[model samples]
Structures are given as structure tokens and as C-alpha cells.
Target: MLVAIGACYLDTILTTPYYPGEDEKLRATNVTRRRGGNCPNTLEVLQQLTSHESTDEELPLALITILPAKSSITSQQIRSAFRSRVNLDHCIYRDGFEEPASCYIIKSKSTGSRTIVNYNDLPEMSLEEFTGIANELGPKATWVHFEGRTPEMTLQFVRYLRKQFPSIQVSVEIEKPGRPGLQELAEEADVVFYAKTWAQNLGYRTAEECLREQSTRTHEASLLCCTWGQDGACALERGTEDFKHVAAYTTENFQVVDPIGAGDTFIAGMLYALNCKRKDWDLSKRLAFANRVAGMKVSQEGFKGLDRALLSFG
Candidate 1:
């Protein structure tokens, strides 16, 4: 089983031919809404990839996220996005208090860049809530990924999970480095995925430098992975002095629709391949598969063909 912990969002995705400047109003080329957020995107991809598996057909997925305050419309939309296999019974629903909804304005024609405006008014999950659930389901999951947010609470969760469920492999996405608990979370996580921009924010010149720096400082992280948009990704495992770089998968033959969730998809693909536990596949092979998965994601809108692409991989 795999569990993903973090925030959930009702994303309003807008597409326009070109990005508008100040005070400019233009009709949208397309508009679609869906359940988004780092955790949800990864969970959704994992759900799809595992759906076709014959050996692990019964494998379970649990999404630990915060629910909006009794908003039926938003709540239902979020639920509808999750697969039937995902366990949502453990989520925390903030009662009476409404969190600001997340919205994304994407310019498809102008190189598929997106402007995200989000408000996280909802409270982060308390340690007590997480402990209660972990106590009940400690041995069920073999792997867990966290969307690094609410640094204190997230650190607590990771600490507890490590202390109690020592056998479980933990991976954390350090997407927001400015969060209060990131340093601790990174130090404790078995695998840390650092965003390229976040690495630059921390004064590292390149992903290799960031990984190398983090490798020297942390004892728990066996693998540190970083993604560089068109340049692809690179990773450095513990005890290694050199970085392994993999070029980005090409999408020249296909139309690039949306690249909003490509990173999450890459993480999901890598996690899925990791959980498969094939001894013959090394780090570069695994990264190649993840790159292909991300390429498939960017070629379409909203996770289309993700499952098929994953299964089709050699």
C-alpha cells in the first residue's frame, strides 16, 4: 500500500491563446475544473497505474488530505476525482471554516505557462489527528509520500512514522522550501525530491550541487532527486560523489497541452516503479521511466493516457 499526505484543491484551470497584460480582458479558449494539489495529483496517477496490475490488484492507496468546510459542491468534486481504490475515510474535514480555493490561469498558446493563485487559509493537519490514523494503519502501507507543507506538522508526522514504522519507506516532495518544517522533513526523509526553483532559492547553483550539499548534511536521505524542466532530471544517492543526469523525454511529435501537473506525474511514476521492487532496474533506468511518464503527461491535458503509458513502458 501507498499513502500520500497533504492538501487538496478544487482547481479552476483556464486556458487562453495568449497571456494577457495588465487590465486586459479576453475570452478564454477553454476552461476546466478538477481536483488538484501535489498529493492528489500523485495519488490519482498512482491509482490509475495500479488499476491495471494483475499481481497487485488488491494493493491499497490512502489519501490523507484536508477537506473543505462542508462545501458539498467542492467536496463532491474532490471525491469524484479520486479513484475507487483510494481510501478517503481518514481525511480531516475542516468544519465551519472555509479555506480559500486554488485557482490556476494557464496560457496554452504562449508556451503553456501557468499562473497559480492559491490561499491556504485552512489549518494544517494536527499531529494528534495523524497519530490516531497512523496508530491504526501503521503496518498497512509500505511506502508514503508527503507534499512538504505545514512544516511543523509534517515533520512530526515523518518523525512518528519513522520511529514507529521503521520498515516503511518515506519520500517527501520539498516543493516549498520556505515552509517552516522543510529542513527537518528533508533530513528525516528516506528520499527527498527537491524542486529546481526551490534549490536555486536555497543558493545552490545546480541540482547536482543541491543534491551533493544535502547528501553531506543528511543521514537519512538515501536518494536526492531534482527536476530541471526541459533539461530533464538528475539524482544523487547517498555515498555517491557523482550525479546521474537523464535528459528530458521528447514531445516533438505530440501537441503539448498542459504541463501543470508534470512534476507530480513524474514523482508518481518514479514511486510506482520503485514500489515494483525490481532489482535489475538501476537508478537511471527508473529515472528514464519517470521521464517517459512525465512526457506522456505534458503531451495531454490532465493525466490522460498516464496509466496506459506506464503499463506500456519496457
Candidate 2:
């Protein structure tokens, strides 16, 4: 099974024709509430792509997320957000926490941009608690992707997973640039995923510029990938001096229905193409597939039918 480790939150999203200016009150055209967060958004896409496959033949997708205490309404909503195809057998229930972490998003329809404000009150998962679940999932895990949060402990998790489950392809999402120790985790991971905003924050103007420079800092990253909004994505394989670039998937309609989970969808698509059931594709196909998956996500309201993006490959 493929496991994703991170925090999942209850999301409140609002849509408006345009982002309002400072101190200006704006009315929303619509509001949507659901379960979201890096890991959950990713699993929403992966579960669909791998859904209905016999577990005996395919590696199932599993989540290792922390949630509110069992009795909370937020916890119940989270539990009900996904289908039976996703394995929540290894989730962590944070006791004494009644409210789930929440995110409020304001999206601009005209520009397809979103402003996000996250509110997380629960405590971070302790190493002991993390290991308890990782140990059980280790033997069955073919690949594990970690959301880059709680940098210090996350770095430790990478080390422990490496020592305990060396055969697994460990991937780390380095979306938050200010998170200290993320570089260390990136150095240890077999795959490192970079975010465009994170790269821009570091003064790099292009995705290739960021990956090519950061490639030297990673000691063991066999694959380094980064997605830039319209420019698409670029990746580098270990021992290669040149980077491969793929253009963004363009839909004829040119519509961006939602951008809230586009990045998560990109990561999910990449994981599916690189290590899931149809993993044997060459690097070019893998990159293109992920691009199309994300393209499809932005063209829709949510993750429903996001897996159809893969149908083109067949």
C-alpha cells in the first residue's frame, strides 16, 4: 500500500468574482465546506485512480493523518469525506482535541487565484505515536509521501522510516519553504517534490532554476520535481545534468473551476504515475500524466472524476 502522512483539516471555501481590496467587504457567490489538507486532498485523487482494484494485485492507498477526538462532529465529517476505497486503519485520533484543524479560503474567479488562512489548534503528533502507526504500515508500504510540516519531527520520521523501511520509496513534499529542517528531509528522501511558490520565495524565477540548484543539496534524491503554474513542470533524475520540462495541460474551455487542491492533485498524480499500478511509464509520460491530472482537477469543482484524467493514457 501507499501511505500518506500529514494533518487533515475541515475546509471552508468561498468563491467571489474577484479578490477584494484591503479593508473592502466583498460578498461571495458561493461557499463550500469539506475535508481538506495536503494528505487528504491527495488521497482523494489517488483512491479514485486505484479504486476497485483487488488488493491482492494492486497496492492500496492508505492515510496516516491526525484528526479531532472521535466524538467531535469535525472528526465525523472527515471520516465520511472519503469512500471505502481509502484505508484509514492507521489514523491518529488526537485526544483532548475537539475541533479539527480548519482552513478558510477566498478564491478569485477572474484570476483563478486563492487566498488561504489556516487555523490549526491541535498538537503535533509525537514521535512515539507516529512510529506506532509507521511500524504497522512499514511492511506493506511500497511508497510513503510526507507533508512537510513540523520540520524537526518530520526530519526524524524520514530517518526512522529510512532505517526501518529502507526498501520503501520515501517522498517528501517541500511546499513550505520557511519550515526549518525541510532541507534535511529532502536530502534523505528518495523523491523530493518542490512547490512553485516555495521556489519563488527563495528568489528563483523559474522551476528549472530552482531544481537544478537544489539538486546539489540533496544527497539521495533520485528524482526532483517542481511545478510552475502555467509553465508546467520540470524534473531532474539523479546523475543527470539536464532537466526535463513539460508544458502545462491546456483545456479547450480554459476554465479553472477551483485551485484549492490543485497542488495536492499534482502530487497525487505524480505518486500514482511514478510508483502506483501504472508506474512503468518513462519519465516523460509520468510527468505528462501528472500535468493532465492537475489540469483536470482545476477544470472541475472537486476531486470527483479526477481519475478520469488517467483514462487518456490507456
Candidate 1 lDDT score at position 5 = 91
Which stretches of candidate 1 lie above 4 Å from their native place?
Answer: 56-58, 69-71, 98-100, 240-242
> In candidate 2, where is summed lDDT lowest over 10 consecutive residues?
50-59
Prediction 2 global C-alpha lDDT? 0.85
lDDT of 1 by residue, 1-314 (tens): 88999888878888988888889998898899887898889888888877776774445789988887656567767777776889998888888765535766565577678878786677778889899988888799888899988777788898898899999999999877456668778899888888987888889887778888889777888788888788788888786654688887775577677888888998987887777634556888878887888888888888856888755667
- Measured against the true structure, the TM-scores of the candidates, in listed sequence, are 0.92, 0.95
- Candidate that scores best on lDDT: 2
* Among all candidates shown, the one with the greatest TM-score: 2
In candidate 2, what are the lDDT values of residues 1-314, reduced to their tens digit?
78899999888999999999999999999999888999999999988877644665565888988888888888888888888878888888887899888999999989989999999988888899888888877688888899999878988888888889888888989988676787778888888999998888889999999898889899788899999988999888878654789998886777878877888998988888776645367778888888888888888898898877766765
